[model samples]
Target: MAEEHEDPGVSLVTVDGIEGKLARVELPDGTLEDWRLASLPQGVKEGDVIRIDVRGGDVDVDHQETDRRHALGQRTLDGLNAQTPEGDLDL
Candidate 1:
């Protein structure tokens, strides 16, 4: 007879913080785990919420949240650029 195994169902997690290329994630059960940021979808950042499919070992980004964050970041960058002195060329 073959043995049966249970699936590790998908989990909803939030990005708590990032250190280097690793992201500290808060699991659905309130536990924290570190996952490689490179393994996750592009543009994931701190405070972003994402869905992790354990069985498939895949991570999905929350598009709406990501888009919102992206917009906010662009605004901040624009503000910084506006404050820069022209012809500085300090790349």
Candidate 2:
């Protein structure tokens, strides 16, 4: 069997199709994190290299907790999009 891997950090990959100005970043562990950019920030584009930052905060691991966190993040992302004239899109 292959060895398991740990999440080193988050990694931002190239942005795919655009809609509301959101970009899909590839998480360190192969998951995707939709980053809502304010007017697609400078130097950010397709095939551009970027790093994903994870802040130190409380996180719940249980299913319910995971769902809660996910929802919270989604809400935060939505707020970010709302703040900008150009809405955020998902990948």
lDDT of 2 by residue, 1-91 (tens): 0111244443233343344667674443455567775434454554343433345332211244234545776898888888877778564
List TM-score per model, in order.
0.53, 0.35
Error of 2 at 42 (Å): 1.3
Would you list the clashing residue pairs of candidate 1?
A: none
What is the C-alpha local distance difference test score of candidate 2? 0.47
For model 1, how does the per-residue alpha-carbon lDDT over 1-91 read when each residue is reduced to its tens digit?
0111233566667788899999998776777889998877788878776866777877787666556756886777777777888722232
What TM-score does model 2 achieve against the real structure?
0.35
lDDT of each: 0.71, 0.47
Off by over 4 Å in 1: 1-8, 55-57, 64-91
Q: Model 1 — TM-score against the truth?
A: 0.53
- Top candidate (lDDT): 1
- lDDT for predicted candidate 1 compared with the true structure: 0.71
